[model samples]
Target: MGMHDNSRCINCEWAVAGTGQKFCPNCGQPTPVHRIDWHFLGHELEHSVLHMDRGILYSLKQLMLRPGVLLRDYIEGRRGNQVKPLLLITMMSAAVVLLNKLVSGGSLIDGGAHQAIATGQAVPEQLQQFMLASRTVGEWISGHFAAFTLMLLPFEALTFWLVFRRFSRLNYPEWLVISTLLTVQTFVIWLLLIPLHRWLPYAQSLAGLMGMVYGAASLMQFFATRPLLSTLWRTAVALGVFSVTSTVLVLVATIVVTWRA
Candidate 1:
């Protein structure tokens, strides 16, 4: 403990006691010199304890080992030691997309452009020219896919929140938190499976299916809190809503992009 004679709160500059005082009474900040010695690694040890729980590895481990339980705890006001949902998802999605670019050296969504050209079904000259001239746009889309996900996430969360309305009266933001974490988990799966796509051929599809199952399980476990059949039906309804909403958004975006091109 810091000495009362020389001890002070770093944050509020208030005096603190030297003996048996773990924290400052005035500012609530932990005392820095808790029986410190020149050779002892107290600062490092304190940092390790305070920061280890907030690391990406800790969040990933929780997501992988007990995603439903983690979400439940987080939603039920037990968030002291857990990662923030938005930050965790953002980091996961960024890591997934960056690693994907490193491994493939191409845009993941470029397959759609390739397929359109390959069809050769009386393609319009302007459309073909636009497509050819849109490599930069495609790269931008690839790099910003995570941003797109975040933008569309509120609508996705709405689907579940609407379908499972009876289970919880919380507003959209609460559901958005759940959706973000689930989406991040999907990105994790995508990162793991993208490299295997060449050999497995259907690896991406498998990952997508796993993501859907994981999302459904999370919803059912965290929100539904009902019988298996009832929870499954609610999950199906949410998925249906998400699918229709995504399709409409994609069509609209495609039209806008093509028009602008």
Candidate 2:
């Protein structure tokens, strides 16, 4: 253990006990408080302990390896060592957006319109207008990718809530949390696969499928009390609902933006 300035509670100024206490009696912060140093590199880092400024890797590991268990634990109040769900997903969204830019030259979503316009390709006046509007909408969505991702999460969360309602005791907010973590795991997958875009144009598709697999696996393990086959079909149904709803929403959004442009 690193040396701790256990004379007083740094947070609340409460007098310390006999140095064995792991948390402050007043503020409840972890004790034996040492500076964030090489001890951070030691076993003291303890990624499993949640809510006290742990690394992002720990959250990703749990999301990948035991996402259902992690979600259930967080929902049921074992949330000490985990990163905030919103914060984690936002950061992952930013990371995924940045990686997409780096590997795809930031053109993956522009649908080749950017290159066509930039190269002075011959085009009809109507087509030119449409391309410009589409490019603008695409750029805006990419720039605000985190917000865009969050906007889509509600639809998926609602689907999950409705599909799993009978088997689940979780409320809508808890389902939202589960949806966020599951969605961000796809971001984690993208971070791993996006760099391969130079050699694998299909990497994004593969990542999407992998994300689906992870989400299905998470639900299967999470609701193990339900029949496995039932869970599988329900999951598929939930995803189908999310897909149709989100697609309509996106199409409407694109139309609005395109019209305004």
Candidate 3:
């Protein structure tokens, strides 16, 4: 019944020139065999929905349910089933910014600035001024969290590459992939904890600790052939490098803002 079916091409109104011909010679469109009026629309909608769910939700499920296996599969060239790490991070960043705004009325950065302004003893005049300005600047950064992350990710990836160079066989680009995926995982933790941290500031520290633990586990899985202790120490070094990198980024951004002001 497959090849025997005959139909015209919708694009060019060409007649069914031959049986079993999938595309029209005149228009290069698929032969509309036994298709309803809404068949093309239905097909496109189904494909879009399927692709979105398969990549996004399925990857998230894998990361949550079996992260080691997920990282292993992705790094080992079984990534067709997974979403792009950068895209995942981009989507999560938007969610995180919105959640922060709703929960804290700004961001953790802004909140910290406010707390420092209110409670700090012997704060220098310049420090106080910077914190005051940081409220606005931090809110802007939080609102554009995706852009902030995009800028920060390269440094984070570089730190990972340098720290793990001796321990893992992965090159810089592969290290970037690991950095992206782990950052996406950490963002997921932030999404859960950021809102809670509004009412309970301790949740922020808890989130950081959780992210560190998750990063270590991801490193071990990613360098599955490496010794366990080697993976742990490399993860520790990576964390230290990443912390310094991120702190520098924040400081640089703050200086830029202050300079502009």
Candidate 4:
């Protein structure tokens, strides 16, 4: 049968057929050999790809040029031309997490001893020890994410209260928008720190550095807009308290996981 025939659909590279039926059975849509019918794909792929292409590039340019400006613009309702903040955050987070896994030697499901033993066969004992000792990339990432929302929600609430207290007219939804921006910023730091962690092998020390960087960034954001000595002092206090709390929680969680295993 020729490529155009339904029987050839399964053999056709473009047609992704499954089950016993032929002729691109998946999605019940006719498969185009050379070109896909735009309407058949529901136009979702086109829309999604276009938005992502434009949104990601635009967001990146803005973020690189003006770190805080994107958040401010988003909060002020200049949203249509740019990507959604949460979507941008999610994409960046996934990319960073994947890169971290690649650099750190793969996923948590890969299993530490198995990977070490498999890879250690030709490698030196010292190198094997190092790989074995390192936390599974999955665990490290999971730990960060699991703690992120819990840790930052309260910090964001406190920040909104301290910084925007006089703007009582701003509703809770407005505070939520601010909080979402802050959360996105935290993920941005993760995008940065993942590479840093690969270069710096001291996990605990790196964790401390990450916490400090996050706190400092938050403090800077607060200070930039508020510009009051009292607000600076309050931000510092709040940040220190949250930093210590987040660190302790992370440590306890890590210890528990280790002890359980």
Candidate 5:
């Protein structure tokens, strides 16, 4: 009947807004959609359920091939095609965690060291508080494994900002985005190495080394105008500064935590 033929959306009564309006303006469902079928169900499952066609792999591939260019582009606002930095790192973090759990059945942080510090009676007098503070830090990190991993974002951003300030016109938040994608790079390296090393602790050293090398390469590309040797030394300084700063923070936090306790 004539009544069966209408320009309105089936999901919502909003009429087609324009000649080529693909989705309803009111409800946002596709206008004049296909009837349910096995093929539609399968396609929906792939697209929505698993996100089989998502930007996850594409982002990783781009990062691998051109880390500095990709990150610099992303920071400069050329980010429509790939996965966002935060999501990429978060997903990579989950992958690393899952793989660690499957292989070692152990937490990324070493709880036994903390437990030993708590239980031992002969930790010496002066070192006792220090040990306890370390234990406190370790416990928190262990308990919040995912968060602990992501916690490096800001500090890393600050570290890079300080070392590369002369070269980069980027602000603090932009550095954070750059840091996050770099973190995704690190996590991807960890994911690959952890399985071979059979656990986090064993794989961690090599993973860290590989990550630093990757960072150096990325910096070289990002600062392509600079000599490669100059970029390499700057990356080295950045890593050293990051390490020292992180150590100081942990020690200061340990003292504060123990003092308050």
Candidate 6:
């Protein structure tokens, strides 16, 4: 048929050049393009794993070098290269929990100690026994960890609100920076508790005081951007709120654990 003829292949709207062709060249109809046997699953897995690893490394680097920079970047829409904040916190918390369990010699709450106490037997006068009587050391630490993290969320929101009160535009970014700082602080607390406990076995009161001090100091890092008076005031309020909230949360966690047991 002529190039301009209307009788051309209707499917492709191509001029019929010959009669022997099985399919239209323009549209490739009747004989479609064959699907290639590409290893799509393998490629997807590889890409996903590579991206996850890269994100983790990027998060770790920011955490180590700049402390609160990840939250700031993430809140500013610069999240493509790093792990998500919640995921980063969870992964680090899980690792810390595992390590603490390993070092503490067993579950923070020793079932054996609990059983002995239940049976009205004389318990050994040791750290583990005290943990059993009070709560497992691991359980105590875990409860505190959970309480500490949860308590930070509101304090973080408040700190950001106060610190960037003038910069209305950067409020959320500031909050995120506070969150990241707290997450890093939690990781640090877990790391430090091991050595502190080992060195001062009979110093539970000292340990509690140190914990409060460190918690206050960690939070002060965020308020450092403000004037000295503002920093002190905000830090004091935040610390008070954090302490009260954390104490309540840990108490509830302990009650629940005891009830369940």
TM-score of 4: 0.52
Highest lDDT among the candidates is held by which one?
A: 2
Q: Give the candidate order by descending lDDT.
A: 2, 5, 3, 1, 6, 4
List per-prediction Cα lDDT, in the order shown.
Answer: 0.73, 0.80, 0.74, 0.54, 0.75, 0.55
TM-score of each: 0.78, 0.77, 0.76, 0.52, 0.76, 0.51
lDDT of 4: 0.54
Per-residue lDDT tens digits for candidate 6, residues 58-156, read 566655555535445655577777666666676666666677567664443224435566677775566334445346434556556555455556655
Model 5 lDDT per residue over 156-260, tens place: 889888877887687888888877877778788888877775434557657777888898888789888878887788789987787687678767888888788
Model 5, residue 129: distance off in Å is 5.3
Worst 10 residues of 5 by lDDT: 1-10
- What value does the lDDT take at residue 195 in candidate 5? 71
Q: Give the TM-score of candidate 1.
A: 0.78
Clashing pairs in 5: none
lDDT of 1 by residue, 177-236 (tens): 888888887888888887875675555557767988987777666644568777788888
Model 2 bad stretches (over 4 Å) = 1-11, 17-23, 29-55, 107-124
131: Cα error in model 2, Å: 2.6
Candidate 1 residue pairs that clash: 1-34, 1-35
After superposition, which runs of candidate 6 have C-alpha atoms over 4 Å from their true positions?
Answer: 1-54, 106-177, 192-197, 200-225, 253-261
Residue-pair clashes per candidate, as listed? 2, 6, 0, 0, 0, 3
Give the per-residue lDDT of model 3 (tens digit) for 1-261.
233235667677788777678888897887745445488677765654355546677787778667878878877899877878888888888877778768776455536665866675668888776776677667777667788778877787787778777766667777777777777877788879876764767654566678889989876766667699988987898788888777776777677777777
Please say which candidate is ahead in lDDT: 1 or 3: 3
- Candidate 6: what lDDT? 0.55
Candidate 4 ranges beyond 4 A from true positions: 1-54, 106-155, 158-173, 189-198, 202-225, 228-231, 251-261
Q: Give the clashing pairs for model 2.
A: 49-81, 50-80, 50-81, 50-82, 51-80, 51-81
